[model samples]
Target: MPVAAKADVVVVGGGPGGFAAALQAARMGASVVLVEKFDMPGGVHTSGLQGAANEGVGGIHTELMARFEAAGYIYIATEETLPEWTGNPLSHYEKMKKPGDRFSRSSFNPEGAGSIMSAMLAEAGVEAMFGTAFLDVALNEYGDGIDAIIVANASGIQAIQGRIFIDGTGTSELVARAGAPFVRGGGPQPSGADWDGRHRPIPGGLLWTMSGVDFTKTAAHQKTAKDPTLAKLIAEADAAGDIPQGLYRPRMTGKGVYGEHYIGHPTLDMSPIEAPDSFILWQNVPYEWALHMDDDARDEARAKSALRGFIDAEAQFLRKYVPGFENAYLTNVGRYVGTRDGRHPLGEYIFSIDDAQQGRSFDDAVTSPMTKTFFWDGFKRHTFQVPYRCFLPKKIDNLLLTGASLSFSYETIFMVMRNFPWCTQTGEIAGFAAARSVEQGIGPKELQWDQPYF
Candidate 1:
């Protein structure tokens, strides 16, 4: 096979985690190569959500914020205006129409994000390969460590060797392909029901934007406890059989109308972007039901076809009842699903939501509450810190993993591992760990980050 450019660190997947891993390693003077299946970086942050890049968590994340700010691609809308019901009995999702305070986040122009990621990679001297897919891994003669990774791109199939590898792929593709052991999204569903594994999968979503929205008129339909415009609309739609039951549980984060199941309730669910238009909000548009993200069942072709059809049906509802969206149009549908959970890398450590809630740390912590904002669940306003062991494969010496596919179970991944901010910091940690391992002639499991590398 041909030889793809090798580096000290090879980060597969150019999403938020891969972006941070590659950028941090390269900035630290390591020859790094970042391979992405998509032509652009920013994974869900750019192409998927378009503006859900939450708060500036750390130096690197803050730097991304500065770039976005300079490009006029976003605005942080975490502060809340509907403070009267701060502690209402109702869940946060049902209390108001515009619910985003603890869930404070920013939005960005996808184009601007791509340009920024590209420019930053170049500035950091990182070799980034887009439209590249990671096939499988070649083990060493002893079958104890990874020798090289097989990849396919415009250059055809090739192999790339590295002292250390970082599996930033959101789906744990590298780790799985390497024959590593992992767990699927099976067990008791959040609804208090057991899943059969094959039939029941975790809930994944895709976010999109609506253009030509009349913000002025839509802005007026904000809901209060006494006058809930969003609830009213859902009721009318449900009565007309246009909306389905169990689609809008209001307080549940999974109940997003922009979801594959329902369209966002203008004022209740979404927020405005920083662009000339602010039609984009936190809505989903993928698998309304269970779909194993790691399985081929949730591949691109199937998700796209299903979501586009839902948008068509959603558009009719938007035009008739929703005030601001009366003239709104589907600007663009996301190319990839904002997958919440996937197979774990089964690292040396299994980071759990319980550990985060308890404010856990490790002797080799790559991220702590001090280095960056810890534990942001956007849904429950939860916060916690992550340890370095979460990224280390339990048995693989030369390989490491990061991002949502770290080690959390289906029930808890969304609360911690999957958040883009945390994933970004973890990527930075993975990169620095890979570089540190190379410099010390050691493996990532033996790497240390008890001190601040950034």
Candidate 2:
């Protein structure tokens, strides 16, 4: 097969990180080609139907949010904004208000946000090949650097050549295929702890949307109905085997901590402001299932099939049991399942969770020191800086890692720095570094972190 397209940078996966990398590289005057299996951009946030900007972010992410806000696609969740959409009196947020509440995230319309992202990529001159899946990669004669990547789409199998390649597939698919060293997620290990690869990874979830919900009725019932808290109803349903066996449940555990789950679904306002009557729901798979779903095709198919069944059950249960969901119906399902943990390509430096909590600074930080990000552990906020070394995958001269697959302890990516803005920041640095390396005619590892690449 002949090479379909050649560019300075070839990016696989057009999620937040991949899209940002392509856009930044193109803006910096490097010819770019980004391939995504989904038809649209904004990976988990768009195609996955989790259109959440969990926290305030800067750099390319800030720009993207600005665009969304301008397009009237964003919904900032807050104490004041909550009641408008659901008609429920804000109790939780009001009680837990803090000085750092300014950094809270906003939700948006997934389809609208995706279109805007596509437009941004095109405007930045990034040639995005949507609905394309990565097949294989061709290594240079020395077997040390990638030369071209094999991808399949409607046009059939083709090769895309580039000087530098970015593995933004979130799971580091490119890096793993190129024979680079990577670490698999080994379920809730401490920062920098060793893993034997025998354990399962963390749990993953699938998100879907339901439309035609009566938010006001739901809120009113939740506040005044006999089972006002929904605890009794959920318990009754669970006892009757109505709720899915493995679905996660949220709990209000004390003041600062709210347990280990997302607050929505059964109660609370998960509806996007664009459509107040629509609710976003998620079904989480247990770690035992997630381990197989990460890399095994057959297992993934099985898990996805099971998840769909769980989603249907949950929808039915909601309509039958929940007061506000009598007329609600499942509308859109995310094309991709959301994984909290998977393969992480090792880099020059593995950022640890301790680094995140302590607000550790690096001499070669790619992130601005003023950028405020937080981890969920007690909701601790920090001004963390990501080093440039984390983007450089070990044993790969021309390949860079981005997104959740970048060098970090599983805890770090899980607890913090895996949000939209952080991933985009990493992509911005990688794209800038890749373009700079190409222009300088040197490997990415040879570039000085402190030097001005631009």
Lowest lDDT block of 10, candidate 2: 86-95
Predicted model with the maximum lDDT: 2
Candidate 1 local lDDT, 1-454, one digit each (tens): 8887888888899888889989988988889988888878888877675566556877678899788888877765433622322222222232443343354445677867888988899899988998888888998877668888999999899998887888888888888887777876543443322323443444566666777776445445644224344667767777898854334444324322222223223323444555434445344432335556565664645655665555565666777777767777777667677666577667777776566556665666554454222323334434455667778776667888877668665545654456777678778878778877888888877765576443
> What TM-score goes with each of the models?
0.82, 0.86
> Candidate 2 lDDT, tens digit per residue, 244-335?
76543443233221233432234332444346566676666644343455677886777688879878887887798887789989998889
Tell me the TM-score of model 1: 0.82
lDDT of each: 0.66, 0.74
Clashes of each: 13, 0
lDDT agreement of model 1 with the native = 0.66
Off by over 4 Å in 1: 76-105, 195-199, 219-268, 281-288, 298-301, 369-385, 452-454
State the lDDT at 255 in candidate 2.
27
